[model samples]
Target: MDRKHVLITGGVGGIGVELVRLFAQAAYRVSFTYRPGEESRQRAQALLDEVGEEGMHALELDVGDRQSHARLMDTLSLPLDIVIHNAGVGTKTVERAAATYKEQDEVFFRVNTLGPLWLSEDVIPGMLARGHGKILLMSSVDGGITHFPRFRAADGMSKAAVAFLGRQLAATYACTGIDVFTVCPGATDTPMFQASTLDALSAEQRRLLEASLPGGRLIAPREIADLCFYLCRDEARILRGAVIDASLGLGVCPAVMG
Candidate 1:
């Protein structure tokens, strides 16, 4: 069989870098996107050099900008077998939602929700023509529900929409050889995770947070990456339309795992 091609958004970030590495190692022709900047370009190039995979490529993308997404779609030279909508942004103005919620919500929807929807529209036609494709949506445990403080409402709402989009797409294209999967990860050990408000937690609070999880630890990005890679294989067909909880036991709380 020919090596498959994958396109991943936000490939320079913690979880995303791991995803790219795993896909490249699996012999997939991988192309990823990062924001516009010399730093982003250099980091992407360095990653490609480190992976030593000729099939790896990178491009500048701002998911929040529709024109940028359009340009990317027009410039793509190959049919994609898999598209991972992994780019996201959560509102950082946590304690000041009253003043910032409106602006933050718009950005959250543009990047975390509407951007993926628009990109999927561009790619699904090609997938339909080929009769085979996969879409992986990166949601969050917060989207479904968890025992956390009521903050980052914009992020949670946008991700919930993403989860819904995945399910709807799966149902719409069921027999068309297109599959959709949504991965709602919990507190994975990613830079984003570490950079969150958790950093402000006291030592005792931090210990409590870690102990709260069944495993007494945060989920690793590589574990999520491995799950993603496995789902793309032929043997995992039954997982179509599945909303997988990669939350390291966080989903066990059914009452909270909405």
Candidate 2:
């Protein structure tokens, strides 16, 4: 039997790293994409070195660039068993891109929504031919309008679209060997979470945010990673088209009313 292969986008990031580690340790040939630049290369190499060079590889990719996605898929030799679309910019970053809401929406939608859509479409044909594959999309609890405290219009719309895309793909591929699903995580503790998502909050704001969730704590990156790994297994086939919420009960409340 051939060695299973998995490709993950934004693999150098917090949750991405955990996902890469779990898959690589499971003996799968893992290939993950990082954005182009020296820092990204260094991050990717450092992680790959820890896993050893044999079955791990990293590529520079801008998931936001459709051309890059197409080029990478076209050049790949291995048939993938799993593909995790985990790359995304936080709402704060999107908000900071420009003063206008239209500008922010444009940037967020392109990266957060279109990136996954295009990349998945590019890879789906190969997966179909191979007759077995798993694709997991990383969305967020921000996708739910009523649950989150602050309304981030672009972020919510983009993530919601991703969730919709996953469901559509799963329905389209029903009964096939291929599987599609989305994982909606709440506030995960990661560098991105710290910098973009939480840095601006005051102590009181942070307290309220934590209290908003059932656990009253941030979700660990590894927790989501473990969930991603589990959902890709054969036993998880019945979960096709599902938007699995690993949100630490954040959505249990109807709204974050003060």
TM-score of each: 0.91, 0.91
List runs of model 1 lying over 4 Å from the truth.
Answer: 93-99, 145-147, 202-204, 254-258
Those runs of model 2 whose alpha carbons end farther than 4 Å from true positions after fitting are: 95-101, 144-149, 202-208
Across residues 153-228, which tens digit of lDDT does each residue of candidate 2 receive? 6777888888888888988999788899899887789876787657988999988877876788889999999999
**What are the per-residue Cα lDDT tens digits for candidate 1 across 170-206?**
9999989898999988878776676674677888987
Candidate 2 clashes between residue pairs 3 or more apart in a chain or in different chains:
none
